[model samples]
Target: MSSSSSMNKYWIPHLDIHKKVITQELQFYLGPEATVRSFTRDGEDGFLITTPGACLTDEQIDDICVKSKEMWEKQAAARAAGAATRVLKRPLHQPVVISKAGASESTRRRRESRRSNETRSRRDERRRN
Candidate 1:
């Protein structure tokens, strides 16, 4: 028997058959809008960002491809712009203040006492060894 005998009119034509097969495969596996629905819908390129296996019409797929290309170009341009504005060199070290020149005496005494206690504990451990 001929393969076209039981096929529908849409399935008989080569172009239509291909589209229908793509549509069915996308729908069977990816649902609709096939891997192109996840993209932002704000511009002409939003449809290219869909999850993998999305089912969409041929026109929609074309639109997604076009938009994705545009987005890629824009992203490349932005990256180039940012790279142009960055500083290449950096200082090795930054100075840090140990203590304020005129801090309260009480706080300083408390910190010193805590440090002395820690030092004493370490010395006592060494003696035991």
Candidate 2:
């Protein structure tokens, strides 16, 4: 296997990052030695993470795996919160439509008032003409 395909590598095959600075954000969390880059292979878009080995001790690989998992969990939770906030910022403004049977008294009054105003305006416009 190639050196780039070692155990220290991680591949994310489906990250939507065109509008995100996820690479710089992750590298900040994972430390300066961490490398994040994009690659295209087999007609698929992917991002790669090369784990930093410069500060690793002579211990087993479990430590790196544990740290990686912790960092990823934190990042995922933050991203989820950001996505929710974006969703909240967009309030739907669709016009309210209802059946006559379900209409309230205030709704009927408002509709009548609007129709009266429209009719009066048309009459005034005809007089002006």
lDDT by residue (4-71, candidate 2, tens digit) is 54437665553334313445455455566567678766878876667744322324233444555666
Clashing residue pairs in all predictions, respectively, total 8, 0
* Superposition-based RMSD of candidate 2 using all C-alpha atoms, in angstroms: 11.5
Local accuracy of candidate 1 as per-residue lDDT tens digits, 12-47: 112122232333343444444333222333342222
Candidate 2 local Cα displacement, residue 110, angstroms: 47
Instruction: Work out candidate 1's RMSD over C-alphas.
Output: 17.5
Error of 2 at 81 (Å): 27
Off by over 4 Å in 1: 1-54, 88-129
- Please report, as a residue range, the 10-residue window in candidate 2 with the lowest summed lDDT: 54-63
- For each candidate, give its TM-score against the true structure: 0.30, 0.32
